[model samples]
Each structure stands twice: as structure tokens, then as C-alpha cells.
Target chain A: MTRFVVSVHIVPRQGLLDPQGKAVADSLRTLGFAGVRDVHVGRHVVLELDAADAASAERAVREMCSHLLANPVTEDFELAGVRPA
Target chain B: MKVGVVSFPGSNCDEDALLAIVERLHESAVLLWHKDHDLQGADVVILPGGFSYGDYLRSGAIARFSPIMQEVVAHARRGGPVIGFCNGFQIACEAGLLPGALLRNVSLQFRSMPVTLRVETSQTVFTNAATAGARLTMPIAHGDGRFTADADTLTRLESEGQVVFRYVNAAGEPTEAANPNGSMRNIAGVCNPGGTVVGMMPHPERALEPLLGSTDGLVLFESLLASVKA
Candidate 1:
């Protein structure tokens, strides 16, 4: 088995309302960062696992995302990185 | 009728629900622990409100996995009435017993105030006692109460008349100004397609007595009793 480090990024699904993201965007613009556009806020989750290979680790992380890490109704998730630790 | 109240580690409204059921509604009520799988033969199951699992990893995210939830899901699947209020609403959606997700309030603050809710339908066991278009005052207290769902789901809910309650003004108009948390379409409550599973962001159990400044919430309890009796 190989030790792997994984990074998961979750964001509100496109077209879903994200009040937190909107609030941050408004605050940024007020702070003189006018170039910022469509600012969206989300969650980043990191996990450490022992799996047979990178493919296996990625698959496990994906399952985790569907089960708990992200809510399909209002949020989407991406498995950002899976690497040997 | 026997009512079962599920209590999670951080649930604060279990006692209130019990008191309301036994004292006000005159029904036998029991507390089901999160780790317990048995429901004690409750005809109706209620998931009371509070910061379950400390609201970690999002509200209701963790509590959905409790051992008792399996029984609750089975109970609802068997067509038993199940009502989830406030944090319980979040748990129900997370558990896939209901549609939509509750996001942070548009104002991003923990809103704790009495708001007017218009009964959109009187067909379900939960709202059968309320007249169509009747407005009732209920207290809402939550930071994440803005309910959102995909357009398709929202359309389906609207078409099926599954929308049980909507935030409204005193005159029962669903205007934007009356929306407390910016929920889409001012939706305050919704039931599943079967109408056996219900979820709402407001605390009906909190407003059941006259001393609490409103007796409108008792209508929901009364409706439940009426349904169970019939």
C-alpha cells in the first residue's frame, strides 16, 4: 500500500445561489479590488489515505465527495490532487 | 398518537418538542437518542432543531449518519409522518428525505425573530388544519435558512403543490420584503412528493403556547394529531 495525500475542492454548483460568495465579492470591490468578478467561496478538504495506487485513492476520494464532502443539490466538488505522500 | 423526538448531541429543542406533544397536543412522546436505532413505536417522528454535531461540516451534515436516522428514513419510507424543523430540516435534506439545500442567510446573520408564514396548501398531514392562504406567525432562528434547489426540482415542487409554507407579509403576499432569509420563492417549508416527509426552517415547537406570543404553531401539531387519528 502507498500513502497518498489528496486535496478536494468544493464550491456551490453553478447557477445556485451563494450568499457567502456574494458577500465576499461585495467586500472585495469595496476594498478597491474592482477587477474581481464572480467571486465564489467554497470549502477545501484534505485527506491522507493508504491505497494500492493513485487511481484507487482518487476513486475513494470521489466516493467520499459524493457521500459527504459535497451536497449534490447545491454544491459541486472536484478532486484537485492525489499524490504519494 | 405516539410521537418520537430524535435528539442529537447538540439538539436543544427535544424537550420543547416533548413538552408540546405531551402537554399541549396530549400525545405520548419519547426521546430517541442519535446512537439508538429503535424508535419506540412512534407513529410520527420529529427531528427537533438545534446545532447538531456543533453545526460542523455544515448543518445537519454529520447528524444524518446517526444510527436512528436509518429508522427514521425507514419510518418515512413506510409512509409515516415525519417533520423536521430548523436544524432537523437541514438534516432531512442532507439525508435525501427532502429536496433542496439550505444555504447561509442572505444577511449572513443568525436571524432570530418571528416571521409570518402563509400556508400554501392544506392537503398534507402536517398542514391539514391550516386554511389555504392563512398566515401564521412562527419564530425562525438560524444562520443558514435560505433554501435553494435546482430549477427543475423547484418547478416540480411547485407543480405538485408540495410547497406547504411560504414566508409572507401580514396580508399573505409573498413579496421579497417579507422573505426573512432570502429563500427562493420565499419558501419556508416543503414536503416530499409523498407528503409524508416534511422539512421547514422555522421552529413550530417553539411557538406552540400563548405565553410564547403565538398559538399558530399549535395548528401544525393539531393537524398531525388529526391525521393520526383519522
Candidate 2:
């Protein structure tokens, strides 16, 4: 089995309501962080796994996103993984 | 024999849930509006999805104080099996019937997608029909599905095996990329001390038929029915 490094973000999918993100953007501006015009929040996750190959691991990771991790309708996942160092 | 789908003012999934429970499964169900009390003799109370009160003032924050929720809490306290989905999960947390709060999505966006759930424990009525490590594919639609709790509570919940399901990847694998809402430790659903009441952000009732593309969720409803008969 090959070990790989998995890094990804889990965010709300487009078209669903995001009242919380809007509130935070306003708060950042209120706090005098003016340079930021648009802000969206999502989780950044890093994982290490042992698999036969990167494709297999990616497939596994993608499955997790579709079935469990990311909600398909409203959320999108950006992921990249490589063989462990 | 009767399934109760609780309906808050803005809840849109009541009828859909009822159809899944009755038409697909051939079981009897009732739509209990938020104002009505008594649960209408429902054996299992299911809190369906929707943006209650328009998701205003935080997801499910206001609905926690609804009249029926009080009774729901009382009923759950007495060891009745209650299932909460999506906003219902948020309301359950708000009412202190379950642990953790459903915060805004990590990306601060609304999420509507199919999620794979890994069954962490199958001791409860809802999950008993499946094996402990069973994987279920279901749809989860919510914004504040990020689950957060105090460190102590988190430890206890983990130690007691209260975690029911976790979001995973498309191939039915458990990994970080699939965790849609940034739930703590990838926690998607949990139960109370009694284990009878379970709250989950994923909509199991939403996937009771192949027309929706999966029947993995039907096991939960069947388990509840079995308990009702027991």
C-alpha cells in the first residue's frame, strides 16, 4: 500500500442560502479589515492514507465526499493528493 | 404503527417525508404542525427538513422554542425514539435534546448534496438494522450543518459511542474531502444518553426509494418500525 497526502476543502454548495457567511463578511469589514471584498468560509482538511495508488486513494476520497463528506447539491470539493513523502 | 413528521411553519419536507414513510414503506404517518400538540399518537416522532422561520436568526434557533418542541423534548426524555433531520437536527441541538450546535457551513455557503454516511454504531433503534460499519448513501441539504460542542462533551460523546454517522467520499470511502459541513471529527449525527433519540443533518427519509437513487436510508425507517412493533 502506498501512503498519500490528502488536502481538501468542504464548502457550502452554490444556490443554497448562506446567511452565516454574509454575517461574517460584514463583521470582518466592521473590524476594519477593509481590503477583503468577498469572503466564503469552508473547512480545510489534510489527511494521510495508505492505498495501492493515488488514483485508488483519490477514488476513495471522492466517494467519501459524495456519499458522506460533501453535500453534492450545495457544496463542492476541491481535492488533491500525492504519494506520501 | 404511526410515524409523526413534525412540521414547523417553514418546514417544506413534511409531506415528502410522509410520502416516503407511507407510500414507499406502506406505513401510516401524520404531519404534526408546529402549533399542534399531543403528537397525534405518533410512536416515532420525526423532525423533517426546511428553513424554519426562514432560517432567520440562525438555523433552527427560533424553532427550538416552539410549543411542540417542548413536548418533543419531554417525550424524548421518557425514552421515545425521535429522529431529526437537517434543520430538525439543528432544532434538536437548540432544545438541548442533543449535543453540539449546527454552525454555519465551513465555507459559509448553503450545501445540498448526496453524502455517504459511515455507521459508527448501530446499537440504537434507527441504526440497528445495519451493521456497525455499514455505509449509507443519502442526501444532506443544509447550511449550518457544522457540528460543534465543548471539549468535554465531545469526549463523552465519543467515549459513549454516540456518533451515528459521518460524511464520506463518493466511492463510499471515509475521508476528509467528503466532510461537507466541517462537522467536528467528521461527526454527522448523534444521539442522547438514552440512545433512543437520534439527530442527523443528512435526510434519511429523503432516500427511502430507488426513485431518489438509493434505498440505504430505508433501513433506518424499518428499524424504527421494528422498535415500534417491539
Candidate 3:
């Protein structure tokens, strides 16, 4: 078994209202960053676990994202990276 | 009838729910801890309001994995009466005991005020005693109480009478101005297809007395009592 560190990024699903992101974008526009199109606030989670290999570790984290890390109904998750810990 | 109010790590309204049943409805009630697996033979279960798990990872997301939730899920699957209020409603959605999801309030504000709700249906166990068109006032305190679902689900809920309550104006009409947190279609409460499980963002237990502003919440407790007895 190898210890692997996985990073996952979860974001609000498209077409759903992201209030915090909107607030941030509004603030950015007020700050003179007129080029801002939009922003969607979400979350990033990092986990360290022992798995047989990198593929298994990524697969396991994907399962975690579907089951608990990210809400399937409202959020989408993707693995940002995986590395030996 | 015995009512069980689950007390999660940060739940603040479990006692209010218990008292609503015992003091107002004259029914027996108990507090079930999040770590315990037993329901104590409770006939009805209430997932009360408050910031369970400190609203981590989207409100009730984390609390849904508590040890007691497994038993609660089983109890719900057995056709037991279950109701979730505010944070409890979020938890119910996370647990899949109810459909849809609660997103961050569109106003980006933690709304803590009383709002008017039009009882859309009295067919569910939670609102059986309420008139179909009755207006009730209750308090809602949450930052993530905006209910959202797919377009198809919304259409089905509307057609099948799953939408039990809606935010309404003083004149009892659902309007954009009446929606407290930008919930879709101004929905304030909903029930499962079977009408046995219900979830709402309003804190009915907090409005059980006139001194607290309204006693309209008592009708919900009365409805439950009547349903269980029947």
C-alpha cells in the first residue's frame, strides 16, 4: 500500500445561482476590474489515504466526492491532482 | 404518541421541538443523540433547526452521516412519520429522505425573521389540520434555505401536491417580494410522494405561542397528533 494525497475541487453546478460568487464578482467590479464576467464560489478538499496505487486512490476519492464530499444534486467534483505522500 | 427530536452536534432547536410536542401538544417526547442508534420507540421523529455540524460543507451535509442517521433512514423507510425543520430540512435533503437541495440564500444573507406561508396542501401528515388556503406566520433563520430542484422535479412536485407550503404576501399570493430566500416558486415546505416525510425551512416550533408572535405552529403539532392517532 502507498500513501497518496488527493486534491478535489467541487463547484456549484452550472445554471444554479451562486450567491457568494455573485457577491464576489460584484465586489471585483466595484474595485475597477471591469473585465470580470462571473464567479462561482465552491470548495476545495484535500485528503490523504492509503491505497494500492494512484488509479485506485483517484477512484476512491471520486467515490468519496460522489457520496459525501460533494452533493450530487447541486455540486460537481473533479480531482485536481494526486501525488505520493 | 412519542416524538423523537434528534440532537446533532450543533443542533440548537432540538429542545424547542421536544417542548412543542410535550408542552403544547401534550404528547411524550425524547431527545435522541446523534451518536445513538436507537429511536427509543419514537412514533414520530423531528430533525430540528440550528447549525448542525456548524453548517460545514453545505449545511446538513456532514450531519447526515451521523451514526443515528442510519436508524433514522431505516425508520423513514418503514413509513414512519418524519419532519425536518430548517437545518433539519437541509439534512433531510442530504440524507435523500426528501428530494431537492437547499442552496445558499440568493440574498447572501442569513434570514432570521418571521414570514407568511400559504398552506398549499393539508393532505400531508404535517398539515392535515390546516386549511388548504390558510396563511400561517413562522420564523426562518438560515443562510442556506433556498430550495432548488431540477425543472422536471419542480413540475412533478407542483402537479402531485408535494408542495405543501409557499411563501406568500400579506394577501396570501405567492410573489417575488414574498420569497424570503429566493426559493424556487417561493416554496417554503414540501412533502414526499407518500406524504409521510416532510421538510421545511420554517421554524414552526418557535412560533407555538402567542407570546412568541404566533400560535399557528400549534396546528402542525395537532395535525401530527391526529394523524398518528388515526
lDDT tens digits by residue: candidate 3, B125-165: 99999999999999999899899999999999999999999
Tens digits of per-residue lDDT for model 3, A52-85: 9999999999999989999988899989999999
Structural similarity to truth (TM-score) of each candidate: 0.98, 0.73, 0.99
Per-residue lDDT over B122-213 for candidate 2, one digit per residue giving the tens place of the 0 to 100 score: 88888887888778998888878888776778899989989988877766666778899878788999998777989999998788778888
Question: What order do you get sorting by DockQ, best first?
Answer: 3, 1, 2
Error of 3 at B176 (Å): 1.0
Model 1 complex DockQ against the native: 0.85
Clashes of each: 0, 34, 0
- lDDT minimum window of 10 residues, candidate 1 chain B: B206-215
Better of 2 and 3 by DockQ: 3
Which pairs of residues collide in candidate 3? none
**What's the distance in Å from true for residue B190, model 2?**
0.4
Looking at candidate 2, what TM-score does chain B attain? 0.95
Cα deviation of A36, candidate 3, in Å = 0.5
